[model samples]
Target chain A: MGGPGNAKIEVVLVDDDALVTRTLSFLFAGEDAFSVQLFNDPVAALRHLEQHPAHVVVADYLMPGMDGLQFLSKVRELHPESSRIVLTGYADKDAAIRAINEVGLYHFLEKPWRNEELLLVLRRAGERALLLAELARRTEDMAAFREKLFRALL
Target chain B: MTDAPGIPDPCRALFSAHADPAAVLDPARTIREQNAAARASFGEAAGRPCWAVHFGRETPCPPCRAGEVLQEGNALRWMMERADPAGPAAPPGVWEVTLVPVRDAAGRVTHLVELLRDVTLTLGLERHLIELARGLDLEIARRTAEAEQLAGRARELQAAIEQLREEQADLLRTERMAALGRIVAGVAHEIHTPLGAILSSLELVRARLAAGRTDGLNELIDLLQEASERIRKVVQTLRAFSRLDAAPVERVDLREGIESSLALLAHEMHPRVAVERAYGPLPKVRCRPDEVNQVFLNILRNGVQAIRGQGTITVRSFAEGGVAVIEIENTGPEIPEEDRERIFEAGFTTKPRGEGTGWGLAICRRIVREHGGEIEARSAPGRGATFRITLPIEGPL
Candidate 1:
């Protein structure tokens, strides 16, 4: 839960089926702690991601043109700090796990997923994304402070 | 001397008392003397050549035993066959002839005594025994040939039984594969999509109720109803399709079976191929609905695959003349003219290796034929390929 001072967790959901994306969008609704965007086309989603940064990206494994792995890999290149998750309808869990490891994705989810579990995973990924951003800001501030000290000593 | 005059003085009584037809021949083969029995059989043949008297020949009888006896200076015997000299109607007779060489005191062969006898009866019995043995040998050969023929038939029957066992095993395996193929395709898209929708929709309703807010409750309930209905229809179709083997026979609406098959294959057709159904009034056909459903699945799947990217599949059904008919047509590349009929042959495939078993169309034809139906393929160069199936309403006899 987020209060007025807390920032909303930004998320993007991608799937070829409009119904699936729509259903996922509803799952994140009425929650002040999360902000969700949906796409039925991986290419279109990639275009949107180039202009706007999302903290967490969730994609379906089976899409017509570009699959989840390819799309998530592209997302990684665009934003390394963003958490990438894959959703698969396949019955084989081993395959899903292998895909996650092969692509260095954040997590793997199955279709017809329990809502509570899905939310928990997405929340954790969002937290990680916020932590990485905060660490990068701290490192930049520390470097600037050290540069100032070196100038003063000279 | 008292019996006959001019006999040799050394053995005169012994030569005259011999009972068998006997004669004495000089070294030149001239008959020198004849005993009483010899004279009775030959009728004063003491001066005639012996071969002329017995065999009525111009030359000495071949292999003359008396001649050999004289040349070798030893006793010899032989069998001879000739016509009976008594009359023309008398049966041919055989004889055993013997020649005895007599030597003087100086060891010179002075004469040879020739002996003969009638042996026709003995030879006739021997010949009859040989004929009976030959007949028995022929009978044994015939019985051996008959036994071999029976064994050949037994071997053929055993081979037929082995072939039947193999075919039954193949049927069981292929049936399981068909079921698995349906499950994979349906589960991936049709049921899972609706299930995902239902689960999330229920969660939203539960959260709202827990929060004591009834604002969007009716809309969520509506979503739940729609999603569940779709799942129910898919489940019903699957259950009916799989239960066909247990039922054995059923009077079913042909259109409904075709619709169920289409439902199972809906995932393959979406977002790429367009499906058009031109169903007409059809009569209920008595058949094994499950097997018939498989036929539809094979054809529809084939239709989906034949299209390279985007195309239309048209399915038509109707009844005419107590026969239900279905025509499935695809707007894709036409099948080659030569492969129209051969596509239904077992082990015939156009797909790449490991992608096709070549049994799909073959099995389809078999199932259709088992229900007293006919299946055929037609294709023109530009129009595309069409499969036409017709089933008799009365069922197989």
Candidate 2:
């Protein structure tokens, strides 16, 4: 078992509702293995993402500045390895499908979520990030080996 | 080549090298040397009559160009529109065929060279252009229809906006009246307390003077007491008028409120008009009491004003199904159906300008709405008008 100290997962939460963000922040505050950062403005969160990357990004669907899908698309372009999740009040299937196809989101959660279910999803997302990091490292090693072989043959 | 009499070397090569089905025939309607193109065009029909190859018939085609060339020895070109008789697989197509006469050494027109070209692809392209033009016309029609519908919708929206503006103006007028009513009610309440004390003191002074046998002083006290009571009545009237702007909800005894309204309108009553009351057991209603009284006063005043000669106005009240129902009926000329709904509107009145403000029924409606009650007037022409008010009763006790 990996201890909380050894496995520190950081997540960024973006939503227009202050109450929802604060509640989610409180829920994550008690966990040792996770760190949560809350942002009411999606644009500000996106600016923060450019400087400081997170293991996972959770966002709300309907917002004033930039909708959840557009924000997720930008996040994917900026940090393709980060896990993305969408929380929405409206059951918009078209938006959800676009997010899946364009942003490659890991999960979608509706509003008024259960604390345990959200935490579990985040934990799973963290594990997925770890696996992706390992896969990228292996791919880089394989590319370098192929370059050496080509040089030796030349 | 034995002086191949009439065939040009380049034209013969063209006929030989061309891949499409082609043919050459003589003016005598007989086959000449069929080139490779002609062999592929008419497989087993080579060496047959030219008309047999073209029309698939035993005889020559009518108005044959080859025959015309043979007669005049001149080059002839023409187009033909004809259906192929060679079954379903035979593509019906237009052909542009030309004929050039070949003369002998004696200058006699002998053979005619016939050349045929298929124009199916070009004709199909023309047909496609026509279909495209038709589709574009349909698209234009649809767009025009959509634009017309949008224009109609815009006009409807404009009319709706104008109507809304009129309604908003009426609401503003009603709000101004409500504000004034509130101010009057507050001022009346403020004066009533002091007026009540003054009247009590005057009565005490009258009693003392009368006991001491001062007759003149007793008359003065009586005058003062009477003036004070009159002021008190005015204050009460003002209070009732202000209640029209009272806060939306409060407990009110419906019967008592109705009686107070009748008392307030007593001064407006004419000698020819008689007031009758049929008070019934009514429960307290949850409403703005002053507003409810205003509704009663307005209807009663209208009823009294409607009668030209002697008339009686009857007021009735009762409770039913957790609601207080009040009716004011008059024995005056009835309102017409066409004018019934318009009567409640501000600035609408059958009475002449000076006799009616026309705002009375409108104000009554606004007050009733604020109390969450309904007021309706029912009448037939010459049957007299009856106004009914229903207010929800407060919970038991």
Clashing pairs in 1: none
TM-score of chain B of each: 0.64, 0.57
Best by lDDT: 1
Q: Write the per-residue lDDT of candidate 2 for residues B1-397, one digit (tens) a residue.
A: 2334456666777766766555555556676666566565565454578766765656666766675677777888876654664222234567666776767678887766677666667777988988999989999999999999999999999999999988967775775575445334434323432343344334445555668744345444544565466567766766655565456566777766666666655533534567888888986688766666667766876886687667788888888887788999998898988888899887788997544657778778877766667788899776688998877786322
Model 1 preserves the real interface contacts to a fraction of 0.41
Q: Which structure among the candidates has the greatest TM-score? A: 1
> What is the lDDT for B91 in model 2?
49
A-chain TM-score of every model: 0.91, 0.86
Model 2: residue B338 alpha-carbon error in angstroms: 5.6
Task: Per model, state how many residue pairs clash.
Answer: 0, 0
Candidate 1, residues B76-148: lDDT per residue as tens digits? 9888877547322223578778888878777778887777776777777878877777777777788888889
Q: Relative to the unseen true structure, what is the C-alpha lDDT of residue B335 in candidate 1, on a scale of 0 to 100?
A: 96
State residue B292's C-alpha deviation in candidate 1, in Å.
1.5
